[model samples]
Target chain A: MKSNLELVNDCDQFPPNRDPSFLYRFMVNGFDCPFGYLLEATVNTFSWPDYWEINHDGKTVKLLGSSLEERNKQIHDTLLAERERGSFKILKGWTSEIFSVYGPQKDLVLSIPRIAAPLFGIVTYGVQLLAYQSDTSDGAIRIWIARRAKTKRTYPSMLDSTVGGSLPTGETPFECLIRESAEEASFPEELTRTKAKACGTVNYVCRTDERGGGELGLFTPEVQFTYEMELPKDVIPTPGDNEAEEITLMRVEQIKSALGKGEFTPANGCIVLDFFIRHGIINFENEKDYIEISSRLHRTHAFPTA
Target chain B: MKSNLELVNDCDQFPPNRDPSFLYRFMVNGFDCPFGYLLEATVNTFSWPDYWEINHDGKTVKLLGSSLEERNKQIHDTLLAERERGSFKILKGWTSEIFSVYGPQKDLVLSIPRIAAPLFGIVTYGVQLLAYQSDTSDGAIRIWIARRAKTKRTYPSMLDSTVGGSLPTGETPFECLIRESAEEASFPEELTRTKAKACGTVNYVCRTDERGGGELGLFTPEVQFTYEMELPKDVIPTPGDNEAEEITLMRVEQIKSALGKGEFTPANGCIVLDFFIRHGIINFENEKDYIEISSRLHRTHAFPTA
Candidate 1:
């Protein structure tokens, strides 16, 4: 019997892949290092350090550094100079505000500026915690969301997760969660350490705006480990620093609508949506892209293992 | 204040990234296609068509064709010839047993033998319906899984979803479900059409074995549109054809163990695990990789939009 096999080439062929934005590359020296992303334009920028060279064929760029010391020194000094020249600005609300640098198989232990993390397309690790509470005995859930201070740089005035901070090197996600919870929202160290649930991670790749004289700014590959804390009805979230302007409680539907209208930071929206899926606020029957959305929340390729 | 920006350069500094196992290429007229995947060896002991040429680059191969029509004709005729020689056999109970041939954009509408799908990394699409029931008045749930006949080819005698069939070129997923349920499980078309709930879709990519010597086989990229049908407590499923040996009802825990022990077909196991998540049997609290598993079920890269 003849079967009607479908003829499908899912990766867009004609108009090119709608997203040619993110490419994976390793900076090579003594070993292959998972360096951050670089724009096609940035790769072609001339006057690279004498010890380093780049090879790219439209898709990916391999940064060939002369040595680990040469590479680290070149990147650190050059990137800092660029930032001082107003080429990059810090995302002040991001926690820990440290960068994760890696050498093949081990932590390089050299953290760059948080704002410069994306310029190199390095996988910037961070922690995000969502604190929720049920006011009534009926178990109706309410979420606590923070608003970034307008005075802060990068996505200022945008809605954010309840508590989040950059994952500094030499720190585990759970440790960062406890620290950020206490510092960002003034959560008791004990409550955050005990009640927080490890939800999941969100991975995304995107291009930075034209930062250096129209040079292809680096592509940013980001990975954030997420957590959720169900607080009692009496718990209140208070901002400890300028990382947040204010913390407010929001209903699930309100958060959903705001996310739909794109009011929250891109990453927070993803983390919140994941909470909805796990909490049973959203399911397959109600959403057509339920499976698709759920999958996007995890950065499967971001981490090597737990 | 000194921020903790730990320095880490993660990757091989001297050596290039290992495991460069797959490559992507497009087949143009008289030129080699930069398609993805490099097999360890050519499929079976058979002579390839004279018009077709394959260039090897370590692991990745470039499939060059004299023309678009030439490439299509060579693959189509060659695969069919091998199947006729008993090289590739039809997988019974598969609705659309046709392989889809694609290069760049636009479907050539050229369908190949279904058995050759995975070898070429072809993204295959199909429909699967999970017919379940809640017998007790206490809102307890039980699932229906089918066992394939021992004599069938491919994963024979393994457990599978309640109702599943390949998605042919012209048929919509809903329509395929209605037809497959009737033909495979003897379900009334009306009940399937009316009672079933559209869950979502699952996407996956897997490599297949070679068919012709040293030729590029199929790389199976599969997308299955899934549905859930909650049947009446007393309804009994009978096999309409020999595709299934028998249908058995299973509890959630039993199915989990079977999945863990690898008793079910790989695809079926994924579908059922998705069922458990939506049904609240498996969740973030119980499953550490809940988000990861849920996301892996959907081919995030497969869909252009969320």
Candidate 2:
């Protein structure tokens, strides 16, 4: 009964996801529309086109499919023009953060965390893009874990943004992604050039209190845009500057092995890695073999099966 | 037979390839060093391993099947170990202007070209990174080009490098690339994460001044390096403030078409596009074919096949 944009505007609006603490910029609509214009009440939560199903809440759920939908929306017509080509849907979403507003609006300025700060303090949302597979050779999905700088201020030495940075201010999640990738790698800024398209968004209430009280322990909710970046064999994980220390390529066997060890850290890297390995990006040579990295985290959400 | 670096230094160099006129920097070694640098060189030139040829000078040359013996003499096992696994092989050379000061260092001071400036003249050289192809889809050779700014004080809007630039004082061409990509794209400084690997060298001369008033035209020589960057599809091409007016994605098909229509403009862009297209890094199906911009002049060089 209502448009997706209308529904997006209904949800709590953040300039880049509305949280000042987070450092990323993202755009909402085709024409660079303002934040909060798309009410959350009108749009559906989101869903992976292929594996979407009903939840206990009995409402359609979407996650990691926002970018996917957005991608499809852009090239749907052109792709359909080529009958032989298979279609990939792109989903869009606003991954926002709410920073506490204090002091006078006139003199007060916005800021982002030192670790997440963009060249400039800009906040935004991104559209998650993804691709699906049925029987890939790897069997297990591949999770790309970005090894953080050992000396990082937050989430130090943990994997973050396999999909990339948070949304940038005054830009859409997609735009934020273009910026993120540039900052992250020597990659060309053409987002749609390769198979690295938007897949969808994963809606989850992520709370990070790894620091205990105050300072780094602040709690905040986040909507993550999952993007699909297909790494060719030659593309080894080489991190850029302090943003990433190294990129640990993960496979499912390692995930299972780590979970068995029972030493789970609060860092979300393992969880995300588990998702990738289960989804078939990473290959498991032997059902019994595993990598040497930690894998003790519990799987909060297992990949959907057909 | 001089050492590879010496041979590279002895070969024609693009003196104009730098800032502050007369300062020259461009050389490439044809040998594989230990340290796995071969792959890095290969990746730098050709976007894919399949697009490369060991005996690049002949029809028998093939990628993925080069024997160690077939590699250039400069390539030794020790050097090979230093190379990365997926790099490209580039061809570098110098211009005749560099030779003018050859016998001994002539007191030379050149200014680097500036936009509105009392043009800063710098000794600039022409370095071309080569991306090899089999001959056609099954076997033809090709290269890439960048449409230059026509109003440029030196080269103007001619198609210069598929991706190239002059070296500033004290900076290597590889470093120049880091500066170039950022300058061209308005990209963040972090994007220049990867280094450009030295491929090989080319020796040739260009006739500059057609006036023939005893003030002979500037003779050109060059040295090019091949750099590989696995860019995300979303990266945009924003061109530098002084270099390009706009960036256009052209394919070999378009180049062939243009060549057919008696419209051979700068062929470098199409040449590089052909390399990437063959490697599966770029797809013409997703990009718009070349559209008519304006009539521009282009040059074709015929060097003995190396």
lDDT of each: 0.60, 0.32
For each candidate, the DockQ is 0.12, 0.01
**Which TM-score value belongs to model 1?**
0.58
On the 0 to 100 scale, the lDDT of residue A124 in model 2 is: 28
* Tens digit per residue, CA lDDT, model 1, B95-168: 43555554433334245556555444455667887888876565568788999889765678988998888877
- Docking verdict class for candidate 2: incorrect
Summarize candidate 1's per-residue lDDT along A116-141 as a digit string, tens digits. Answer: 66555676667888888866556578
Q: Name the regions of candidate 1 deviating beyond 4 angstroms.
A: A1-26, A39-97, A103-110, A131-143, A186-195, A209-217, A229-242, A246-253, A273-306, B1-88, B91-122, B125-153, B156-202, B208-217, B224-264, B268-306
Query: Chain B of model 2: TM-score?
Result: 0.40
- The RMSD of every model to the true structure, in order and in angstroms, is 10.2, 25.5
Top candidate by DockQ? 1
CA displacement after TM-score superposition, residue B112 of candidate 1 (Å): 8.3
**Per-residue CA lDDT of candidate 2, range A204-255, in tens?**
2232243322223122333444455666555544555567676556565554
